[model samples]
Target: MNQTAGLAVGHYILLKDPITGNPLAGNPRKIENIDVATRTVTWGTAYAPVNVTMNAVKVLFHNAAFETFGRVDSGGYLTLADQAAPEGSPANAAWLWSDGTSRALRVRTKDGITSSLNNGGTGTVAMGDTDRTPAASVHQCGVIVTTGTLTSHRLLTLPPATDTDAYGKWIDNTCTGAFSVVVRQSTGATVSVPNGAKAYVWLDSRGVTKLM
Candidate 1:
């Protein structure tokens, strides 16, 4: 079996059905190994060793804008955008995607963590000056900030938990009182964030109550 040109390991090859001239069942097979000297190609454990003819097989190319296992569309392929958080289940975080309009992928926290710096604050701290509103598509994380003397307590309010399984982070910067930092969710639930402590909060859809 001779190896074909431009074919390398990890490339997916589609095996066509001989009779129907269509992709065979489970057609796309990954190239596991290639040996140029012996002229052999291996496609995992599913495919048998066969002479590599480039024209005989179809190769799938990688899409730079899309991630692996992304949704395919008529235009080409759709990258992963933000996903709805699953209730009581481990799921993937929100990801940036293209929809032809916005090329910039923006993920923001309560602070000034922007996507431009890969969400790294770079040692700079932002004040909790503005209140954040809740949206269906965005996940918000709030970090309490204290200015001047930490004598007076500051309050941080989170948006209503309208969406199921909504999650966020609350960081208390106030140094004086353990109850200095407070967080109030839309469900009338209030939590006092500990000084210099961070808490992960999520809304349990089953009970409709916010949990820390």
Candidate 2:
């Protein structure tokens, strides 16, 4: 019974009259607290103190994307990567590089932390030395153009276990050249995005899902 309201802070919700099956008069209340486990919401006037079933509340969602890479849980809160950049340190980013020997993609974040990019499997990819982390969020999403001849295919890694509901996609930008952009799962599976193609790779409770 996943009756929890997938709402965020500062979002407005309409409170309905439980008995009449209609919105309560003057009942467009601002959401203050959400209890997912209990599927309850505590909102409305502080002086009045109203609690209601989450399913009865109508929520308005604002469209937005993450400005920083982190873990976004079911509650919609973000937990940024733990690494830190020194003052005046050059902003950095990382990339997913394919390792032929290991047959996996290795990821290195901006903070110089190196780890295997999970391929939705048991094996971990070998790490590459190149720093592929983008400097800003605006540069995060979009087509990536490679500079030189690609030795091995580059992959876009999926979010870790913490970001179970989140997914990522890579659009192959090359028009004529046969560029290989792949989505590497943590479970050791690989899905390729052909040149001039795009695919959505997401991880859910069930497993890694691909939407081409």
Candidate 3:
């Protein structure tokens, strides 16, 4: 599907007839062999020597493979060959590049704002506490659970704030089937919870994916 042409210098053009200045689409142009001893180009036909030299003529053609990564893919895309391999080939590694290496997670660009690969089933994504708002402020924090009953997950009250809307990143994941969270207080050496109060559970990643 591609055509190409190259010149080795001091050679007659292959497709142009010198006498008529017409395209040699179907005709042939003769190029005399170089005389190494005289260091000169000779012409076999009636025309004079063209006096061709390096950079004298421009090369033209379609090179689909020039943009190809190491001639591996005809299409332009970054493949394994375009990157360096890891120190050792690990069993957990997938998505191998041509360089004989692997990675657990790879971020393609520094300016890209999002992570594309999601955990297999469910996982947690948390924004920092400085950005949290309580009156349905849209930035709700939660965990994505994929296994055992959800009752075990507990949400402790957001830590008491000296500043308004203050938050913390600590979350707990140890509860069972549809239930509520509880606040516990320590009295000297003993701990107790007040009666009949609904609690909110913190969120956590269930560790269901092996991204390496």
Candidate No. with top TM-score: 1
Candidate 1, residue 36: how far the Cα is off, in Å = 46
Q: In candidate 1, which residue ranges exceed 4 Å CA deviation?
A: 1-19, 23-151, 174-179, 204-212
Q: Of the candidates numbered 2 and 3, which has the greater TM-score value?
A: 2
lDDT for model 3, please: 0.30
- Please, what's the RMSD in Å of model 1? 14.1
- Backbone N/Cα/C clashes per model: 0, 17, 15
lDDT of 3 by residue, 58-92 (tens): 22322222332344356775443354533343333
lDDT of 1 at 61: 40
10 residues in a row with least lDDT, candidate 1: 116-125
TM-score (all chains, Cα) for each model: 0.36, 0.33, 0.20
Q: What does the lDDT come to for candidate 2? A: 0.47
**Which tens-of-lDDT digit does each residue in 1-212 have in candidate 2?**
14545675556666555566677665666666777777666666423446654543344433434434468789997554433332333346454444446644455556455454443312222214222323322123333332323345665454443353354434443423455545554555566655456555555444445665
